[model samples]
Target: MTTQDLTNALNALSTGEHQNAIKGIKRGIERESLRIQSNGAISPTGHPKGVGSALTNGHITTDFSESLLEFITPVSESSTQTLKQLRDLQKFTLENMGDELLWPISMPCFINHQDDIVLAQFGSSNIGKMKTLYREGLKNRYGSMMQAIAGVHFNISFPESLWKSLHSLKQSNASLQDFISDGYLSLIRNFKRELWLISYMFGASPALCNSFLQGRKTDLPFKKLGKGTLYLEVGTALRLGNLGYTNSAQSSLRVMYNSLDEYVAGLKKAINTPSDIYSDIDDYTSEQPKQLNKNILQIENEFYSPIRPKRNANSGETPTDALLRAGIEYVEIRALDVNPFSEVGIDIEQIHFLDVFLTYCLLKDSPNMDWKEQARSTENLDAVVNQGREQGLMLNDNNTPRSLQSWGNQIFAQLTDVAKWMDKAYGVSYYSETIERMSMWVNDPSLTYSGRYVAKLKESGLDNGHFALELANKYKQSHIETDYSEFLKPWLEQQVEQSNEAQRNIENADAQSFTAFLDEYFHKN
Candidate 1:
């Protein structure tokens, strides 16, 4: 698109006229009673459970043993069965829950290697240890064990090859059966696309190395870095890994690399090749070499990796080995927190809004944008996270201070036009709803997840742990109300059984445990 064309599109979108559109859509949302009651429970102050103290000081940590196994598994080529199983397992976990502490810390998956490609996949709760412990048949056998390890979470990652496979599949006029069998492939592809779009918009660029971390010195300083990838806080990463994205960092990096390479190549080709149809594009031939390579590797290793180490030194796993094994590409976005109130990590409406916002970031011409803008954006993110919607917390824009609501409203306006375009292209009514929701958020920032969370904490008169407990209870209630609870029965049974067996084995063992057993079970040769 021409510069003027782009500018007009943005102007139309940022006008904030979609408020009425969202009000209409709100009728479709299934409303439930908001139960606000507090039971006295204190949130754990320091770090999440199951991670080392060294790694817990506000950075990502990993189980190197698990990472090593995952590296060889080729998790990207997971099948439809695997995806369904994961969804089912998650549903099951949501059922029969107590506090967050009693939940499984990680979502378990099995990875299968296919030459040059990996298929990382999650299992049904019935398949492994899950069947014995938490299932209905075994609940009495392991209820106590379940309560002790509630807050754990984990996830798995698949390879880029899987997306390529899906893209190829989409090209064909496949029958319904074919598509059903390949649904997981399609889901991953969509997820990857969303990730790519967001990464390009919010990721740190090599050019503005001094900005992302507020001028913190980077070991791999480069002249230019791309924007758009989201950086996960230490807490978020730990929670996600515990939830079951086993290869969260590695899988995320792969998606970023593949997406970025494609994006940059397309842009470079467009700029270089003369296009008679759209001849108004500017030339980038004068771009410097330093500005080109961008030292992406250095940025990934020096700044990003250290903050979220894949394995601990005690585990004999080095950051270098982890990156090499996982074929680390670009940085990954791990900052997003799933709204406990929503069924999915992100709602479909929010996804639609994000699409427009991300596209705008990409299509807009911002060659002159520098580190200062990056710094300002970082500050804005922090403010939104910690003090969002609070009185006196305003985001600064180009030296002018503006209320977050005003800035958000301006963004919503741009989003509205984008949604209209999408509605025409995709024929989906949801895009318009997305635009509406964006307006709602802008008009009342208190409706945001963060804002709601703070509010809930205050209203419940409980600490963080109790709030988490209440959320868990609500999720359980929702799960029981749905049809997916049956699938969880077997897995829960197995988990209970497994926990019982472990307890029995411990009771029979000598007070002084056998050194050989510990060596064989806990430590790798």
Candidate 2:
């Protein structure tokens, strides 16, 4: 589509008129889904098998490592096989973790591949003590447990050609800051509905919301609900959690500048020396201990630059104003855990539901709705989490309360229209089937396996640890209970063969010492 076509489509959605917004959302979902599907089913390289299904099972205690190891044993047998499989699983888990819990199946629009992302470091329980651990250098002293927080990374992507054209135009008449501001304004104007969709998705899941809130230090103004905190307070938790931590506005700019500088330097080097070996030399030397240290430091700088200075006060650099300056259009969703029950990290059906829900949020018209209305929506989300089926939430339309089931039905009805449009546009019959299956999950509570599992767990009164142990035992029994000797035979034989090959190579080598043989072996490879 031409830029104008895209601009017009976005404008239609952002009008915030009920029917117009629904039409715009329908068009956008179809277009975006088509673009992504054309690129290929987002089969990210590394993800644990069965993670999505496991999460749906509502059994949080299943050990991810056990299930992962089981899935790979049937596929390959190499010394590095286990490590390679684990890495892939972790990557998949991290990527699809947001599928069930957050809105908008796609990543945030502001994130580019090259943009700097940060993951905050704060212990699950004592934020204050965690700070103390870092302050007293106990992180180094205590090691693993002291460094308990998960680190999040941010990256951004943009249309490079369009960006260049815009940059050139700005240079003739405007400053860089002015150009960036104007560019973002245009981006928001075009993508606000999509952004709101993202916010709604993130806000829908209390479990995911807790991920951003439970581990932070913040003092923002908050709304309370009868001694229990409101969902907006959780949003505030994310704001405070990430304010000077993940995606610190100013730090990202510096990282971007540094990346550009590095890119320029590499370009200059390539221009000066046409030989392919010039780049290869750097790669070869990277393995050397001294060079490896330097490479590690560079990577750390690029990845951690956004939050490092704030983490270390002595660094004296202050955070950028980018986050505060921009309107709060999208909130990051971080609370998804890998489902141990699905063959893939997320199910295709669940992803389809996510698409429908996000589109419904974007298409819904009510920009003038007060904070009270927003709070009600947030409460509905919490009710879904805490007692979704038991105490069905009340959805508000223009300040009127409706049952959650009724609201869901209306949302799915819109999805049906989008599905019909997509089937016609993409010539895919499965599109309708996918949306239909998703609609069943919403309309028929019996199909909600996640909620059922939670109910079972509560009925059984099994604590998290015991429940996890039982699941892990089941996994072990499924794999290892079958003749142990037969299972180990293939792996052991492969290991023996590899060891013999290494021995032969060592025996034939002319190296004077073992260290020399090691160096030569690695270097040759």
Candidate 3:
């Protein structure tokens, strides 16, 4: 849809309506980190009890590795409230961490070796064992060290009221579930078409510890830094580039988001399909399972995409099963790199911009992506990640070629109108103000987080290890200096104790043998 079309639809949806689409924008953040010591090496400690049990805690959990702590905030409509909660979680976790510091960066700077990185250990329960086994499978398929890299997942969904309003505006005969699914699919399609814009603007990992390469051959023009750091002058996010979490076996997946059936079918096929390479691993017949059946995906979560159509699974239900049963509930955005500059890894401005951008994507016309368009998006993402800040950089906008600056300007121009409508609906100027400040990044690349970090590295001549250690220490001290919130202290303490009790109950209640448990889990497929 054109800009004018989206504006007309917004006007129609807003007329005689007491609710605003912007206010109903529910968002949650999942920020991941590796526990690091004062010297910036990955901490060998187990998950801290003060942080809460990884098994039962809804807010605090481990990602892939034991030391990699993931903090999740409950869904909130207000960006300020969401970020405050995230900060509170961070401060609480830091308080419980003792001498360990939260790694202040996305790309891990220091590591001992692959073997030094251990998979997260959940206790003796069948469910806990299954979770750890999944990580072990990932480690066996990829390497242990690769799973230790940190990033953030942004979970977002619009209110059903907003969707019903849109449905009424469309005068469609589709069921609510089908309508919502189709609408979200349209949003996903547009997101894929334009994701390079986000990568160029928000990408921050331009460099990383050289040890990440581990002798892999690459054509990237990398320059050596002090000690173990290697950098690319034009790189935007090396973490999103090559040396990050990826699955070669699953790259053949053509999970189209044009419709719910097609999307789910594609995912279903992948999870059921076997991988020849993975099948070679020796299954531990006498002992525990080494990896979940040598399928292309052990579960639906194994298929990595920048954005995912998510339906919160029921107890023991697979992600695909949930989507099939109840349709898409929300979307998970996995493209963003953790902003190292922010104490909590994200900020209000960025969240507001996403709200506006994603709203525009939904309102605008989105055609289904074909193979050619998908290939173009893949290439565009590579260009943005590798050399987005380079002068006169160009990306394909459909069949037409446009410079990054020109395309960004065009999007920002539309977003200005979107922001105005949001401000009017929400009765706040915060959205407009965010667009105004972020527009500067389009005109001046150096103002971008990645550009500034690259410049800082050049000036200081510090390796990734030294640079990140300094920031980690600084943030650690900052969190320490800030007084703990008296209001949240009791609740935080209760959550930790409650989660531990929940885990113990689950452990005590298990009736099935490990062999029977594994069989039942795979029966979902």
Candidate 4:
């Protein structure tokens, strides 16, 4: 697709819109934060019963570790409402726990060793056991320290009306679901090309406590701060780089995104294919299974990506099956870092910017990316994650070296135009306001989150651990003083009981043996 193609698509969207098409966009968030003790050690307790059952609660759950809490919000079109829900959830959690504070940043603070991080647990049901075992396999494959790292996931689905308008504009003969899936794949491809910009702006894990690596070998140039803190002068998010959440074993699997069938086929192949590296670990037949299977990836979630095409799965249905069943429902953006600036990890300004950026991704024409382009895109992301704040940083745009400032300015111009259409839909200028404010950060490195975090540490003459603890305490105090706004205490109390009862029902309903359940889950239609 050319520039003219983008113009035509935008023109069609504006002229063909009906019944507030742009206002129909639905969004939700899954934010993760680790629970830490008063002195900044990882909490050793289980998921708090007052919070709800980790296995059944839709609003609150544990991610990889029992201490790493994940907060979810209900779907809404308004960013303001979504954030209000997020704040109340956090406030409720704070009210439940005695004094445990949520870790404010992506990289954890002052962990002793890998063994100290505990895996998340669910109750007696087989599915619950499988969830815990999946983390066991992760611990066996990668260490627990990597699992402790936290981030925010943004899930968004375009309004069905907007999809209808686009489908009509294309005038194609394919089904609506197929067209939607293809359009999302195109967005994924385009996002991969420009993800470095996100890491530069929102990435906050530029520095980390020395023990985070667990004394692993590395050659990256890391300079020391006041005490025990390791940092790179020009880094953006080390959590996104080679030092964090990276898998060297799955380097050979380049999953395709040009089509849903191809993407599913790629994941299925990885699931079924056995690996010599993982085969040595005890698997499904073991008395206590150490891993799910001997494959390169035990399950779909293990295959990490910055974004995934998502469809809410049914009971016993795998992620790939859900995609093949209904094409695609929405996109889960896994690239966002936990911004330390906000108590909720993500603020409305960021959400507004995301709305404009992702809509711009859909409106812009996206071309299919070959292997060479994909690899180049990864290289670009690596450069930004490591050296985004470097003075005179250059990024490769399809084999051409260009200044980051020039590329960022070009993208923001398109984003501002897209923001106008989005704002016109809701009779509000929030989208344009967010874009204009963020545009300045693109030009000035010091205004970015990573830059400000490093500056704060330096100005205070404190290490990463002390600085994080201060912020965690401050946010906790703020939450304690405020009353619940969106979700009241009465509603939250009712939800906790409902979630626990739901977990009990699932446990009582399980009659089949664990072996049979696993077999049927893999072989079912």
* lDDT of every model, 2 decimals: 0.32, 0.30, 0.84, 0.88
lDDT of 1 at 73: 9
Q: Pick the candidate with the highest lDDT.
A: 4
User: How many steric clashes between backbone atoms does each model show?
Assistant: 78, 26, 1, 0
Q: Give the per-residue Cα lDDT of candidate 3 at 494.
A: 92
Q: What is the TM-score of each candidate against the true structure?
A: 0.41, 0.36, 0.97, 0.97
Residue by residue across 1-525, what tens digits does model 1's lDDT show? 344656564444333442122121100111111111123121222222222221211111111111211100012222233333333444443332223221111211111211111111112221111111112211121121111211111122222332233334346576433332233222222232223222222221101112222233433312221231112211112122222122222322322112223323332333233323222222112221111111111112212211121221233443434443332222223433334454422344444554455344433433332345434554554444333445445777667888766665665666676667556544567777867855775555455554454455446655343445555456555545666422355654465455445435544543532333323422331
The local lDDT score (0 to 100) that residue 2 gets in candidate 4 is 56
lDDT of 3 by residue, 1-525 (tens): 677887787678667773475467899999998898777788888999886789998988998888899999998876778887888888888888888888877888577687778789888899998888888889899988678888888999988888888888889899999999999999999998889888888888888887777777889888888988888787788777767766778678888888888988998888788789888764423375788677888888888899999989989888888998999999999988888888889877789899989988888888888878887988898898888899899999888989999989989998998888889888999899999889989878898888988988889999977888888888888876776543287898899999999999999999998768878777756
Candidate that beats the other on TM-score, 1 or 3, i.e. the better one: 3
lDDT of 2 by residue, 14-75 (tens): 33332122221110000010001111122122222223222111111011111111112122
- Model 4 accuracy (lDDT, Cα): 0.88
Off by over 4 Å in 1: 1-4, 7-87, 93-332, 343-345, 485-525
Better of 3 and 4 by TM-score: 4
TM-score for candidate 2: 0.36
Kindly report which residue stretches of model 2 are placed more than 4 angstroms away from their true locations once superposed: 1-87, 91-331, 335-340, 343-345, 363-369, 391-393, 455-464, 470-525
